[model samples]
Target: MASGSASLMWFRKGLRIHDNPALQYAAEGTKFLYPVFVIDPHYMEPEKNAFSLGSARAGLNRINFLLESLADLDSSLKKLGSRLLVLKGEPSEVLIRCLKEWEVEKLCFEYDTEPYYQALDFKVKNYASTAGIEVFSPVSHTLFNPTDIIQKNGGRPPLSYQSFVKLAGQPSSPLSHTLSSLPLVGDVGSCVISEVPTIKELGYVDIGQDESSPFRGGESEALKRLNEIINDKEWVATFEKPKGNPSAFLKPATTVLSPYLKFGCLSCRFFYQCLQDVYKNVKRHTSPPVSLLGQLLWRDFFYTVAFGTPNFDQMRGNRICKQIPWNDDDELLTAWRDARTGYPWIDAIMVQLRKWGWMHHLARHSVACFLTRGDLFVHWEKGRDVFERLLIDSDWAINNGNWLWLSCSSFFYQYNRIYSPISFGKKYDPNGDYIRHFLPILKDMPREYIYEPWTAPLSIQTKAKCIIGRDYPKPVVLHDSASKECRRKMAEAYALNKDLNGMVSEEDIRNLRRKLKEDPEQEAKNKRIR
Candidate 1:
C-alpha cells in the first residue's frame, strides 16, 4: 500500500459507486484519486464497412440513455467531494496522456472482455507496464469472472443454460466494500474535465421518453428499483420467467432492471445477494433457468461463452453454432426495421423497441424470430446489428447470443418450432391492446383484425380508419408459407452442414429465394438431396 500516492480511476461500463471492486481498490492506500471517463471515437465513428456514418455506431435512444447514465454518475461522484473528468479521444492515447501529465502512480478499472475492449485494455496495460505504472483491474462487471468459471469447467464454457447454472451454482455474498470517503487529487494539469456530451454533440437527435417505459438511468434509480422489487417478497418468490407477459404494456410483469444492469448502474452481485435474502424468507422460491435469479445466470452464461468463443458474434467458424444459409433481404428487413411490416404484433414490438430502447424478453424473442427464421428469413447478424444500435441495454455477448438462439443458428436448434408472428402475441394480448398502444394506426382497429389487418375486408378497414397497403404496408410476406419455406431451408442447410463464410453463392441462394416466391417443395427436395 503506497500512502500519499495519486491514482487514476478509469470509469467504463461499471459506472456506479457501490460494490465496485476497481474503485474500492484504487481508493485504497492512496491519499488522492481522480475519476475519469474517456469517450472513445470508435463508438462515435462509423466502421469502414458501415452502411452509413451519419448515425455512427449507436442510435439516438441508446445515446440518450448513455448520456443520462454518465450524468448520473458524475452527480454521484460530486456528492463525495469529487468529480468525473470526461475526455474525448481514443482511450489509449487519452490514458497515456493522463498517466504522464497527472503524474499518476496507478491506474485502476473494472475488467472487460469484449473483443474490442479487450484489445484496448491490452494496449493500456502494456503502456502502463512499460512506464512502470501499477494497474489495478478487478473483475466486477459480472457476478463471476467468465475466465474463472470457464476454467473450472475444463477450459470451455458451458453450452447449455442448465449446464452453466449447475457450474455457477449460487450467488455468493456481495462484497462488503463502501466508499465512505474519497480523496481528491492535488491537480489535474491541462486535463480540462469536459462535461458528458449531449445527444446533439454526439451527432444524434434525442429520442423523447416512451410513456410505456418509465426508466431513468442512474445509480440512485437502480438502487431504488432494486429495493422496490426485492421488498415485494411476493413478486420475488412467485416470479417465473416464462409466465411473464411480453405484451403487458401497461406494466411489464418482470422487474425491467436489465438496462440498469447493462450500464452497471446496479451491481449484479449486490442485486443477487439482495434477491437471495428475500428469496430465503419466501416459502416458494423459484429456481434458476427461469427465475429472476435465472436471468442473471443466463447473462453469465452468455458472457462466459462470449469470452471463450472466437467470432462469437457471427455464425461462420462458431463451433457452437449450426451454419444455415440465411437470406439477406434488405427490402423486407427495412420494412421490419421501420415498423411497417403490416403484422401488427411484429410491428408493435419493433415500435416499442425503437421508442423505449427496451422490450420484454418474449417480445425480443418474437421480433428476433420474425427477422431470422419466422418470416423474413434474414440473417441473424442483420437483426443483431440493428439491436446493437437501438437497444440501450445492448450487450455484445447477450445480444449476439440471443439472436443466435432465436434464429436457431446456435445455442438453440428447434428450427421446426418457429414463433408465429400473429398468434404468439395474440396468446398474451388477445385483445391486441399492446398493438393498439404502440402502433396507434391500429388503435381504432377491431380486436379480431388488429393482429392481421390485411385479412379484414375493405369496409372493416375503412371503419377502423386504417387501410392496408396505404396507411400501413401490407404483410412483408405471408407468415405461414414463408416460415414453412424458412424451416425447409433451415432443415436442408442443417442436413448439409456446409460452412458458409460469406454470402451463400447467388446461384445456391437463388433456389432458396425462389422458394419464397413459389411453392417449391419438390424442387427443394430434388435439388437438396442431389
Candidate 2:
C-alpha cells in the first residue's frame, strides 16, 4: 500500500459532490483524500439492472452517465485538491488492494437499498473493520428514510402515494446545494482521464437512430434542466397533458432527471433544494412546481423502502393484493422483450424503451399491462428483468413496486384495474404521434385510427397500407376478455389465504385450489392459452 494519507470516498449510485453525506463526512475527516469508484460486481455486473441509452443500450448509457458524472466530479474534486481514482473488482477485494497503494484508513459512500449491493456493502465494511479501517454510510438517496416514516397501525407502509406525500413535510434548515461552491484544487494537477466506452465495449451492437437528444450529465446539467423544466411559463401551466405525448419531445413536460437520479449525478436534496429555490425565490411567482416535487418525492419514497427492506426487489405474497400463476411462454415473453408485440401502441412504447433505455413513466405501465394482461403469457419478473437491464434510470424499489402495482398486486387488483387499450392510446398519445415515431409499420395509419389498427376493418386496415398479422400482429388479446380472465385468476389467487385480512396459513394453496376446482370453467380459463 502506498503511504500517502488518503481517505477513500467511494462513489456508487450517489455520484454528486454537493449535499452528499459520504462526501461531506470524508471532506471533514481528511484534507488528503481520493474519491474512488469501483467497477465492481454491483456496478459492472448487477445480476439485473435497467440497461439502456439512446442508441447506447442502457448498460452503455449507465457507464456513460457514470463516466460523465465522474469527469464532472474530477473537475470539482480538483477544485478541492482531490481526484477520483477508478478501479475494478469485487468491492471488498478492490478496497483491500487500494490500501496497498494509498494510506487509506477511512471509507465513505452512500447507503443502498438493493439486496445485491447491500450484501457487498456488508462484506466491505466487515473487512475494513478487521483491517482497522473505518466505514461510514450516509443517507442521500431519499428525502426521508423509510425507518423514519411512521406507518399507520401496520408494519405495512402507506399503500397510497397521495397519503405518503401529505405527510412528507419540508426539510428543516434547507441545505445550500450547488456545484459552483466546491473549492479549487491546489494539490491536484493535470491527469489522464480515459473516455468511457459506449455499448460496443459492453458487447452489444448499437441499433436505430441515436435517439438520445444529447442528454447532458452532472449536477450542474441536472439543475440546468430542472430550471428549464420548472420555469417554462406557457408549458409549465399545461405540463400534465403534453408531458406524456411524443410530439412534445423538446419541452418534455416530464422532468428528464432520471439518468442523473439513477447515477446520483445530482442529489435528491439538490433536486429538491432547486425546487425550494424556484418556489421561494423565482420572481416569476410560479407555484414552485409543487406538482413536480410530488414526483421527486415518489422517487425518494421508493429508495427509502428498497433500502430499508431486504429482498424487496422480489414480490411479497402479503403485499400485492393479488397474484396469479403467470403463463410460462418463452416465445411470447421474448417478443414482448424485443419490442415485437405488434400492437402498434405497444410496439411503439417498447421501441422507445429499446431506443432510449427509457420512455415516459406512464408508458412503463401501459407496456407492462400489455405484456402481463394484453397478449404475452409471461411472468411479471421476466418483463421486469428486461426493463431493469434497459432502463437507464431503473431503481430496484420503484421498479419492483411499479411492476407489482401493475400486475394485480394492490387493492382493486385485477378487479377495477383493467387498462382500456384504446382509451389509453387516445389519452396519452391521442394523435398516434408516438406510435408513428417508433412503429414504422403503422406509419401510414391516420392518427384517429392508429390506436385501434385492428378495428379499422380489413378494408381500412389494408387501405391504411399495413396488413394485420403480416405487417403488424393483430391484437394479442381482446381487452374485455383478457381483463375478465385476469380478474378471475387474481381473485382465485387471493383466496389462497381466506384469512388474508389476518395472516397466512400452510396448505392455503390447497384451499385455494379446492375453490378453483369447484369451478371447472375457471380451471379451464386459469390455464392461459398463448
lDDT of 1 by residue, 104-204 (tens): 78899989989988999999999999988899888888887898889989999988887887788655555696787787855778876688877677654
Q: What lDDT score goes with residue 91 in model 2?
A: 65
Residue lDDT tens for model 2, 233-314: 4444444522455324444547778888877876676666666656564444323224566667777666555554445555
For each candidate, what TM-score against the reference? Answer: 0.92, 0.82
Worst 10 residues of 2 by lDDT: 183-192
Compute the lDDT for candidate 1.
Answer: 0.82
C-alpha RMSD in Å of predicted model 2 compared with the true structure: 4.9
Clashes of each: 0, 22
lDDT of 2: 0.63
Clashing pairs in model 1? none
